[model samples]
Target chain A: MTTLISVPLGEHAYRIAIGANIRRQLPALLAEYTPLTPKAPALIVSNPRIWRHYGTEVHEALTQAGWQVTPCLLPAGERYKTLRTVEKIYDAALRQRLERGSTLFALGGGVIGDMTGFAAATWLRGIAVVQMPTSLLAMVDAAIGGKTGVNHPQGKNLIGAFHQPRLVVIDPDVLVTLPPREFRAGMAEVIKYGVIWDAQLFDLLSQLPRLDRMAALPAEQLLQILERSCQAKVDVVSKDEREAGLRAILNYGHTIGHALESMGNYRLLNHGEAVAIGMIAAGELAVTLGYWSAEAAAAQRALILKAKLPTTIPAHFDVEGLLALLQHDKKVQAQKVRFILPTAIGHGEIFDQVPTELIRETLHRLQA
Target chain B: MTTLISVPLGEHAYRIAIGANIRRQLPALLAEYTPLTPKAPALIVSNPRIWRHYGTEVHEALTQAGWQVTPCLLPAGERYKTLRTVEKIYDAALRQRLERGSTLFALGGGVIGDMTGFAAATWLRGIAVVQMPTSLLAMVDAAIGGKTGVNHPQGKNLIGAFHQPRLVVIDPDVLVTLPPREFRAGMAEVIKYGVIWDAQLFDLLSQLPRLDRMAALPAEQLLQILERSCQAKVDVVSKDEREAGLRAILNYGHTIGHALESMGNYRLLNHGEAVAIGMIAAGELAVTLGYWSAEAAAAQRALILKAKLPTTIPAHFDVEGLLALLQHDKKVQAQKVRFILPTAIGHGEIFDQVPTELIRETLHRLQA
Candidate 1:
C-alpha cells in the first residue's frame, strides 16, 4: 500500500493517491465522495486520443459504480488552452445542462488539467473537480495544486482562478504509454524539486539510466518519487494557498521556463524541456554571482545533460522575441522582467531588483 | 469622526469608511499604499451621469495629489452588467497599458462596481481596485463585499471571481445627484439589512422622512446607517465567505426580485425596486405560512410605499416571462429556482424545495 497524501488548504484539502494501475480504483475514489454533499452529473473531459484509449473503461467503471457520468472530448494541443476553447467547454456544459452541483473530471495531461480546472472554477461561479492525471507531467506537478487556468496571448496563465479539486487520483500505470521524449519532459519538473529542496533526489535522477529507453518508471521507484514530489507540493500549498511567499519556491525554473515556452511558439519544446534549459540559465547566474562554486554548478549541469536534456537554448529562437515573452511573464509582467535564480545548489532566491545589464549578459549566453 | 469598522478577512480585511464626504480623503488613502505599492496611472470606471456630476473633482483630486486618473464611463443600467461591457473595459485597460499593480477606481454604483471589480480581477490574473460608490445601494451593500463579476447571458453573476477591493470610499455627498426613484431603489437593500439582522435599524428607517428629495444625510445619521449596514454585510460575509449558508440570508428578497428585474427588461424597475416588490411577495408568503401577522405584513408594505418603492409587479409584466426569468436567478439559476421567503417580521428562510404551485400563487398576487 503506497499511502495517500493530503494537501491541507484550509477547507480545500484534497487527497493525492499513488500506486500502480490505480485507474481501477478511480470508481472507488468517486464513491468516497458520494456522501460529500452529493453533486449533480459528473462531466469527464478529455481529448480524442485519450478517449479512444481509456475513455470507455473509465466511463464504464464510473457508470457501473453508479455515477451519472457525462464525457466531453476537447481538442488536444497547447493552442486549445485559450478562452476560445473555454467557450466551447462552456457551451458543452450548458448544452448538457451541468449545474452548480456537478463534478468535473479532468482526465488528461497538463493542458487538459489546467483548462478543465479553470472551466470548473468559472462555470456558475464554481464546481467540484477530481483530477485523474494520465501523464507523468500532470501527475507530479499540475495535478496537486489548485492553480487552474488557460493561457492569455499576452502571457501564459494571465487569466486564471484558484479553484481546488475534490480529489486527485494519480495512477503510475497511466504513465506507461508515454513516449521517450514526453517521459523525459516530465523529469524536468521532478528535477526542479531536487534543485530547490532535496539534494538526495537530485543524486537519484543523476544515477537513473538515460530515460530514453524507459517507457514507464518501475512502480516502486515511481511511487517513491511521486509521494515525495506531492508531499513537497502539499507542504507549499498548505502554507500559502494563494501563492504569496512560500509558493514562489515552486516557480524555481518557471520564470525562464515560461519565456522559453513562449519563444518556442508553445510547440517545439515541451514544458519540462523549457524548464530544463531555464535551470541551466539560472545555474549560470548562480555561478556568476558567487552564490555557488563552479564545481557544484558544473555537476548540476552534467546531471541534466546526462538525462538527455539540452542545456542550451535553440539557435533559431529570436532573442528579442524571447525577451518580449519574458517581459510578458506574469510574475513581474509589470514594469520589468524579473528572474528567480538559484542562490546555491538546493537553495533559490526570487530577485526582481537585479540590474538589466546582468539580464542582458545572461540572455547573450543563450545565443548559441 | 465616526470610527470605521473593519471586516477581518486577514489580508483582504478592509474597513467601510462611513462619514460625510470621505471623498476628500482619497488622496491620503492613495498615499498610504503608494510608498509600498506604487500605482501611477489609474482608470476610473463610472457611468455618464456620475461623470457629469463628480468626475472632474475626482480626476483633479487624484491628479493634483500626484496620480494620473483616466475615466472610463460605462452605460448606466443593470442590463449593462454583461460580459460584453466587461470585455470593453478590459480592452480600455489594455489600450491604456494598465500595469498589474494599477488600481481600477469603481466610481458609479453597484453595476459599475461589480463590473469594474471583475475587470480588475481578470486583467493580468488580478489587480487592485478601490470602490468609490456613488449610489446608496453600492455604499451599503455591493461596494463592501469582495464578490465581483459580470452576468452571463444565461444568468446574473454567472461569470465572476472573488476579488476584494483595496478600499471602499463612501461619499454620501454623491447621493445629492441621485434621482428620486433611484434613491428609493437603494433603500430596499438598506431595509434588507434591517429585516435580516437589526430590527432597531428597521424602526429608524421608518422614522426617516419619505425619500422624495435628494440631500446629504445628516452626518450622524449617515454614520450610524452606513456603520450598521456595513456591520450587517461584514458579519454575513465573514461567517460564509463563499455564500454557503448564513450568507444566503443576504438574499432575502433577491430570488423573485431578479425575476421581476428581468421581466421588466432591467430598465423599468431597478434592482432595488424589484427587490422592493419581491420583499412584499415574501411578506405575503409570511402571511401564508403563519410566519407574519397581517399587521406586520401591512406595516412592511406601508414602509416601502412611503419610500415610494414598487410594492407589486407591474400589470404589463407577463407572469410566464417572470417565471422564465426566475429560472436564471443567481441563487437558484440551475436547481429549480430557490427563493428566500419570509418566515416572520424579523426573519426569512431560503426555500429550495418549494413547489411551483406556491410560486404561481405568489405571481398571481403580484398581478392582482
Candidate 2:
C-alpha cells in the first residue's frame, strides 16, 4: 500500500511517497512531474554500502524507464560529507554532461542526501534533485527539507542552501537493512515531534509493539511512524522554509544536541543519540524553570527510555567545554544561544535568554 | 550630487546610488537600510590595485561611522576570477567571524564583484553583500543583477547562484582611474544597451564629444552615460530578476562573447572587447537572416568602430574551435545554443533554432 504526503511549499512544492517495495514506482513517480526528454541523463549518487544493496535494482528501473542513468558512488560515512566529496560528484556530473535538464537521484542516508542535494543545488546554478532516503533518520528528517549542504571544517551545515527536491521517496522496505542503532537514533526525532508539537504521536510511540528494531514492529505500525514523522517535518518546513521563526521549534533539542555532537567530535555520538541526550537536558531545564511539570518531564524521559535512546551526558565531558561549544553554535545570536524548552508535553517555546548558570547547573547534574 | 535609481524587485528591491564622489556617502546610505550592530565587521573584498587608490577613503568612512572594516585584498585581473579566489574570501570571512549580519563589500571591477558576490552567497548559507563597482562594466552590467557566479574550468559561470545584493553603489568619480582600454571596453556594454533596449541612448553615444577616454568626455556627459546605462540594466532586471524570459535580452552579445572569451582562454581578450566583437557578429548574422536591416547593422558597426572596439574575430582563431566552445555554453538547452538576435536597432529576441550552417558561414565571413 502506498501513502502520499504533499508538501505545498509554494513554488518549491513537491510530494513525499511512502510505502513498502515502492522503489519500482520511482520512474513513474518522477515522470509525473519532471518533463524529462527521451534519454535525459540522471546521475544516481550513493555510497558504496547502500549502492551495493540497491544499486542494480534502481539502475535497471531508471534505465528501463528510458533514463540514461549512471551510478556515482562515494565512501559511506559522516566524515566523508565535505566539499571535497562534492567536488568528486561534480567531476562525475561533468563527465556525464549532466545539463540543466538533468536530474540527480540521491540514494542513501543523510550524508548521501545532503551531499547530493548540495551538488544538485550548485550544478548549473541549480538543478532538480530526487531524494531517495534509505535510512530511517534520513526519511524522517534530512530528506524532507530542501536544506542541502556539506559540513564546513568550521561548522555543520554552515555552507549550504535551501534548494527543494522535486520528490522525496521513502520506502519502509529499505529500513529493514538499516542498522539497529541507527533506527533507534531516528526515534529520537520521532519523540522530538511528540514533545514539541504532537501529543498523539507521543502516545502512539509509547504503545508501539516494539521501538528498538525494525523487525519487531508490524508493517502498518512502521508505516504509521514514517507517515507521522514525515508529515510533522513537512508541516514545519512548508511553513518556515528558511528557519526564520517557527521552524526553529523543529530544533527542540538541537542546541545542546549539536554541542554534544561537537564535543563528541561527531564520532562518539550519532545525531539521534546526541539529540536524545539534548532533549533530556532541555526537559530538565524546562522543569527547573517551571515551564513544564516535573511529572510530565518524567513521562517524557520514560518515552525516551522506552525508545532506548541516551538521556545523559558522557562521564568525561567537561561543563565549561560544553558551555563554550554551546556558545559557538550558529543559532547563537547576540551572545545568547536560543534553547527550545518544553512548555508542555506537546508544546515547546524558544527561550532566547536561558540563564548560563542554569544551563551549567543542568549539565553538572547530568554529569553526576 | 547623488542620483538615485530604484530597482523595484518587490522584496529584493534595492537602490543604486550613482554620482560623482558618492563613495563618501557609503556609510550613510548603508546605515539607512542595514540595521548594523555596533562595530559590525565588513570585509571589503577587492584587488590590490583598486584598493590602493580608494581603499583608504572607503575604510576611513566606514570606520568613522563605527564599522569594523577589514580590507581583504586579492590580485587584480580577469584570470583571477575563479572558485579558488572565492575560497580566499570565505577564509577571510571566517577568520573575521562574519555573522549573518556582517556584510561583504565588493570593491573593484566585474571580476571582483562577481567573485565577491558568489562568496557572499555561499558563506554561512549567505550574508549581506553591498556592491561598490569600481569599473564601468561592473556598474552597468555585473553589479545590478542578482546573478552571482565563478567560472568553472569547463565553462564560464557554470557554478553560481541568483543572490541579490542589499545595495549597489556606483561612484563615477572613480572612473577617472580606469585605464583608457578598459573605459572603451565598458562602452561595448553601453552600446549593447543601446542596441537591445534604448535607441535614444544609441543616438546619445553616437553624438558623444569623445567616446574613447573618460578624460575626453564632459563630466555631465559621463554622469548621463552612467545613468542611462545603469537605468537600462535596472529596467530590464527589475522585470525579469531570474533570466526566465525578457532577461535573456541582456545576453544580446554574451552568447558569442562568452564563446570567444573561452576560446581565447580568457586571457588575450578582455570581456568587453570580446563582447564588442560579438555584437558585430550578431548584428551581421541578424542582417543575413533578414531579421534586421543592413543600415542598422552598418550603423551598429560604425558606432562600435567610433568607440574603438573590435569588430572582427582574431586572425588565428579557429572557427570549429569557436563552434565547439559555443556548445559548452550554459544557455544551451536541448543541445541547441540560443542566440539573442536583433529585431531592430533597440530590440532583440531570443533565437534558439539558428541553423549551425548559418553560424559557420558568419564565422567564415568574419575570418575573411
Candidate 3:
C-alpha cells in the first residue's frame, strides 16, 4: 500500500511516498509531480555500499523511463560529508552535462541525501532533486525535510541551503541491510517525533515488543512508524519552511545532539545516537525546570532505553567542551544558545534563557 | 542625493541605493528595511585591493551602527573566485560566531559580491547579506540581482544559489580608484541593458562625448548611468526572480560571452570586454537571420568601439572550441543552446532553434 503525505510549501510543496519495495516506481512517481523530459540527463548520487545493493535497480528504472542516467558514488560515512566531497558530485554533474531542467536522485542514507541535495540546490543556481532514502533515519526525517547541507570542520551542517526536493521515495525493504546500531539510531529520531509532536506515536512506540532492529517489528508497525514520523515532520515544516518559528520544535534533541556529533568528530557517534542522548538531557532539563512532569520524562527515557539507543553522554565527553560548542551553534542568537525543550509529550517550544549553570548540572547528570 | 530603486520580490524585496559618497548611509538604509539587532555580528568579505581602498570606511560605518564587524580579505582577481576562497569566508564566519541573525557585507567588485553572497547563502543555511558594491559592473548589475555564486573549473558560475541580499548600497564614489580598463568593462553591461531593454539608454551612450573612464563623465551623467541600468535590471529581475522566463533576456550577450570568458580562462579578457564582443557577435547573428536590422547591428558595434571595448573575437580563439563550450552552458535545455536574440534596439527574446552553423559563421567573421 502506498501512503502519500503532501508538504504544502506553496510553489515549493512536494509529496512523500512511503511503501514497501517502491524503488521501481520512482519514474512514474516523479512524473506525477514533475514532468520528465525524455533522455534528459539525471545523476544518481549514492555511497558505495548503498549503491552496490540498490543502484542497478534504480538506474534501470530511470533508464526504462528514458532518463540518461549516470551513477556517481562517494565513500560512505559522515566523515566524508564536506564541500570537497560535494565537489566530486559537481564534477560528475559537469561530466554528464546536467542542466537546469535535469534532476539528481539522492539514493542513499541521510549523508548522501544531504550532499546530493546541496549539489542540486547550488548547481546552475538550483535544479531538481528526488530523495530515495535507503535508511530508516533518512526515510522518517532527513529525506522529508528540505534541509540539505554538509558538515563544516567546526560543526555539523554549518554549511548548507534549504532546497526542497521535488519528490521523496521511501522504501522500507531497504532497511534489511541497515545495521542494527543504525536502526536504533533511526529510532532515536522516531522517538523524537513522539515526544515533541505526537503523543499517540509515542504511546504506540512504547507498546512495541521491541524497537532495536528492523527484524523485530511487524511490517504494519514499521509502516506506521514511517508514516506517523513523516506526518509529524510535514505538520511542523509546512507551517515554517525556513525554521523561522514553528520549525524549531523539530530540533528538540538537535541542539545538544549536533554538538555531541561534532565533539565526537562525527566518527564516535552517528547523528541518531547523539540525538538519543541529547533527548535524555533535554528531558531532564524540561523536568527540572517544572515545564514537564517527572513521570513523563521517565516515560520518555524508558522509550529511548527500549530502543537500545544511548541515553547517557559518554564518559570521555567534557561538559565544558559541549557547552563551548553550543555557543557556536547556528541557532545561537545575541550570544545566547537557543534550545528546543519539550513542555509535554506532544509538544516542544524554543527556550533561549536556559541558564549555563543549569545546563552544566544537566550534563553532569547525563554523563555515563 | 540617493536614487532608490526597489526590487519588488514580495517578502524578499530589497532596495538599491545609488549615490555619490553614500557608503556612510548603509546603516540607516538597511535599518529602514530590516531591523538590525544591536551588536549583531557582521562579516565583511572583500579582496585585498578593494579592501585597501574602501574597506576601512565601510567597516567604520557598520561599526558605528552597532555591528561587531570582522574583515575577511581574499586575494584579488577572478582566479580566486572559487569554492576554495569561499571556504575562507565560512571559516571567518565560524570564527565570528555568525548566527542566523548575523549579516555578511559584500564590499568589493562582482567577484567579491558573488563569493560573499554565495557564502551568505550557504553559511548556516543562509544569513543576511548587504551588497556594498565598489565597482561599476557590480554597482549597476551584479549587486542588484541576488545571483550569488562561485565558478567551477569547467565553467563560469557553474556552482551557485539564488540568494538575494537584504540591502544594496552603491557608492559610485568608490569608482575614483577603479582602473580605466575596469571602468570600460562595467560600461559593457550598461550597453547590454541598452540593447536588451532600454533604447534610450543606448542613445544616451551614443550622445556621450566619450564612453571610457569614470573621470570622463560628469557626476550627474554617472548617476544617470547607474540609475537607468539598475532600473532596467530591477524591472526584469523583479518579474522573474529565478530566470524561469522573462529573465533570460538579460543573457542577450552572455551565452557566447560566458564561453569566450571560459576559453580565455577568465583572464585574457575581463567579463565586460568578452561581453562586448559577444554582443557584437549576437547582433551580427540577429541581422544575418533577419531578426534585427543591419544598421542597428552596425550601431551596436560602433558603440562598443566608442567605449573602447573589444568587438572582435581574439585571433587565438577557435570557433569549434567555443561551440563545444556552448553545449556545456547552464542554460542548455534539451541539449539545445538557448540564445537571447534581439528583434529591435530595446527588446530581446529567447530562441533555442539558432543553428550551430550560423553561430560558427558569426564567430568566424568576427575574428580579429
In model 1, what are the clashing residue pairs, if there are any?
none
Candidate 3, residue A112: CA error in Å? 0.4
Q: Give interface RMSD (Å), model 3.
A: 1.0
lDDT of 3 by residue, B48-87 (tens): 8988888888889888878789999999888888999999
TM-score for each predicted model, relative to the true structure: 0.92, 0.97, 0.98
- lDDT leaderboard ranking: 3, 2, 1
Count: clashes, candidate 3: 0
lDDT of 1 by residue, A81-132 (tens): 9877876677677666677677888889988898899888877667788898
lDDT of 2 by residue, A1-368 (tens): 77889999887889999989988789888877545544556799998889888988999998888889899999999888987898888888888888888899999999999999988888888888999999989999999888888777777887777789999988999988899999999989998998998888888888875687888889888899889999988888888887778889999989999999998999888999999999999999999999999988888888788778888899898889999988778776655689999998778899998899999999999873
**Model 1's DockQ score:** 0.40
Model 2 lDDT tens row, B150-267: 7766767777777888889989889989998899989899999999999988888878756888887898888988899999999998888877789989998888899888888887
Give the docking tier of candidate 2. medium
DockQ of the candidate models in sequence: 0.40, 0.58, 0.84
Checking candidate 2 for backbone clashes, the offending pairs are none
Better of 1 and 3 by TM-score: 3
Per-candidate iRMS values, in order, are 3.2, 1.8, 1.0
Specify the highest-TM-score model's number: 3
lDDT tens digits, residue span A1-368, model 3: 78999999998989999999899888888878665564678899998899889999999998898889899999998889999999999999999888788889999999999999999999999989999999899988899879999988877898999999999999999999998998999999999999999999999998997899999999999999999999999999999999899898888898899889888877788889999989999989998899999999999989888898888899999999999988877788788888889999888988989999999999998888
